[model samples]
Target chain A: AGDAEAGKGKIGLCVACHGTDGKGIMPMYPNLNGQNATYLESALKAYRDGNRTGGTAPIMAPMAANLSDQDIADIAAYYSQL
Target chain B: AGDAEAGKGKIGLCVACHGTDGKGIMPMYPNLNGQNATYLESALKAYRDGNRTGGTAPIMAPMAANLSDQDIADIAAYYSQL
Candidate 1:
């Protein structure tokens, strides 16, 4: 199942923009709180695969470049609950 | 002071993905609640200027492209408090 606490541990870089609350820093960075894990997983996968291009994609593509599928799940899970 | 009320009015489009509470829909869209106004403002400006590019930037760029500085500010102000 989605583990919010586990995801929180993995969000080091994510917190830089998205913020600790998952509320996002604003403007470009989006809010992560209460988003569906499915959408989060898909977007992260797209960023990792280079299918999606937009603001911070380059950065996220690289950041997500090494993430395992499970990691994506965990991160998505954590933010979704927020 | 930041007008959360006024910002809420302009956040109609934002709420589509971000949700009414500023919590993002998940994985892709970010949470908007409790983010810093300055950070939100900067991010929005980046989207407007095409400086930051990533997952949703294309849609956001065009979405934000038409916004004036004050609009950006207002939106930022709105989301930061949420």
Candidate 2:
């Protein structure tokens, strides 16, 4: 598991869509609060790797493009606990 | 909106992976507890329509293939409330 504090610092890019509390700002976006950390990690990695596509993939791909594995893990940890 | 009682009757195929409680039985699957109903509905529709691909898409596609719009709505409603 990654550090939640570190993840919080990296969530600036995510808050615009997922919100500070991990709830999506729009219906099209899924809420991240209390989601499984493993699932979130995999989803983030999929977005970063260009292995997932559909719906908001176009937007997420770019946002996740620069994330490292540690970044993904941290973000997942933070969101899963929300 | 969908009827939760109706959805419960339709979860026979879902229990193997998502479990009866909407929590995935494995790390590879996502926990559906407390998800947004709209997002869950859209996701189910995407799977049924072949519009989304990646990760568990292959598995989900077949499972969702026979679902009608009402089935999707009811299932989403049931899972979102879990």
Candidate 3:
């Protein structure tokens, strides 16, 4: 997947909760750094589609709503490298 | 949180993708068996709220749409134990 500088900006909201390192700030946040890219991609889609549910739903549903398939792939690539 | 047998039924959808053990069979699925509870909870919410995005969005968005806060918490507890 190609790196999108635009996607990096989109990830800011994620950094706020997951941290720049993807280690996550609170117990409520997950460590996204080094997570499997394919897995992360599925998770993002699941959140968008509503297959998963939890405390972060309110925050995730909207974030995922607008993502294109390519955007999802790109983000997944970024997180996988972190 | 109290163990909800009912919640267990709801998690079946997750099992299909995450596997009964949470190890995840596909590259697209994440291992949920041992994720941190608080982190998992927040993630679920992020999906529900549309803050996260990815390949599994279509499936996840609708799944989380109807979940109650308690249901989310109970499921998080179960996944944490797995």
Best by DockQ: 2
Ranking by DockQ: 2, 3, 1
Tens digit of lDDT per residue, candidate 1, span B21-48? 7776654566666666765676677778
Residue A51 lDDT, candidate 2, scale 0-100: 65
Q: For candidate 3, lDDT tens digit of each residue in A1-82?
A: 5264545656865777776667767776676765667787777777778755556666777888888777877777777676
Question: What lDDT does model 2 reach?
Answer: 0.85
Quickly count the clashes in candidate 1: 23
User: Candidate 2, clashing residue pairs?
Assistant: none
Superposed by TM-score, candidate 2 places the C-alpha of residue B10 at a distance from the truth, in angstroms, of: 1.2
* C-alpha lDDT of residue B29 in model 2: 88
> Candidate 2's residue-wise lDDT over B1-82, tens digit each?
7777799889889999999898889877898877888888878887888866767878999999999999988998888888
Cα deviation in Å at residue B55, candidate 1? 3.2
Per-prediction interface RMSD in Å: 5.6, 1.8, 4.4
Q: Name model 2 segments beyond 4 Å from true.
A: none
TM-score of chain A of 1: 0.90
lDDT for predicted candidate 1 compared with the true structure:
0.73
Candidate 1: regions farther than 4 A off: A1-35, A38-63, B23-28, B51-54
Candidates 1 and 3 compared by TM-score, better number = 1
Just chain B of model 3: what TM-score? 0.81
TM-score, prediction 2: 0.88
Instruction: Report the C-alpha lDDT of model 2 over A9-82, residue by residue, as the tens digit.
Output: 99999999999899888877898987888888878887788866666778899999999999998998899888
